[model samples]
Target: MKDNIIDARGRACPEPVLLTKKGVEASPNGVKVLVDNVTARENIKRFAKNSGYEVKVEENGEGILLTLSR
Candidate 1:
């Protein structure tokens, strides 16, 4: 299982979710998404969850970290 990281900070709306989807499609094992705002964080989490992946979120000074695993 490989871990893929998608940095989506400062990006708006669907961009973050899109990157997350791409990362997940590329690496089904795990995906770490870095987002700057609450909206992006929630959106990515929801997308991952709805796609059958387990979501874990962590708060950081720069932004939020979403760890998605299958």
Candidate 2:
């Protein structure tokens, strides 16, 4: 089954990424994280990559969608 989704909009620098990290830790399969800032997107991408999860990031309107699968 697909894991959880984390919507981290309106949250400033690092919070989104931090929350995403927590979501990743909580998931046995993986998770999808949505963030509206470039920095947050990059941070999640870096974390996912470093953690060895397969990641896909897409542009959704003004926000970014990150799908992580382990």
Candidate 3:
């Protein structure tokens, strides 16, 4: 696991979103969040966008990779 990477693959709903919030807070430059489900990906994407960040999404094996940056 990387310091700027949040692995929320096995988690669900609010947990993934919450982890992403924290990750973004801690990483001033950017944050990379990993989630295995669509819900988490969408939720995090919306949250990041609402919070004034740019989200870059991509497929990561069996999961999704969301990269948030200001």
Best TM-score among the predictions, by candidate number: 1
Give the distance in Å from residue 34's predicted Cα in candidate 3 to where it truly belongs. Answer: 0.4
lDDT, candidate 1, equals 0.89
Ten residues in sequence with the least summed lDDT for candidate 1: 1-10
User: Which model, 1 or 2, shows the larger TM-score?
Assistant: 1
Q: Over the stretch 9-67, how does candidate 3's per-residue lDDT look in tens digits?
A: 99969999999888877886679998999999999999999999899999958689998
Instruction: Give the distance in Å from residue 25's predicted Cα in candidate 1 to where it truly belongs.
Output: 0.6
Error of 3 at 7 (Å): 0.2
TM for every model, in the order presented, reads 0.92, 0.86, 0.90
Q: Pick the candidate with the highest lDDT.
A: 1
Q: Tens digits of per-residue lDDT for model 1 on 1-70?
A: 5557789999999999998888888887878999999999889888988999998899989689999988
Candidates ranked by lDDT, best first? Answer: 1, 3, 2
TM-score of 1: 0.92
In TM-score terms, candidate 2 sits at: 0.86
lDDT, candidate 2, equals 0.85
lDDT values of the candidates?
A: 0.89, 0.85, 0.88
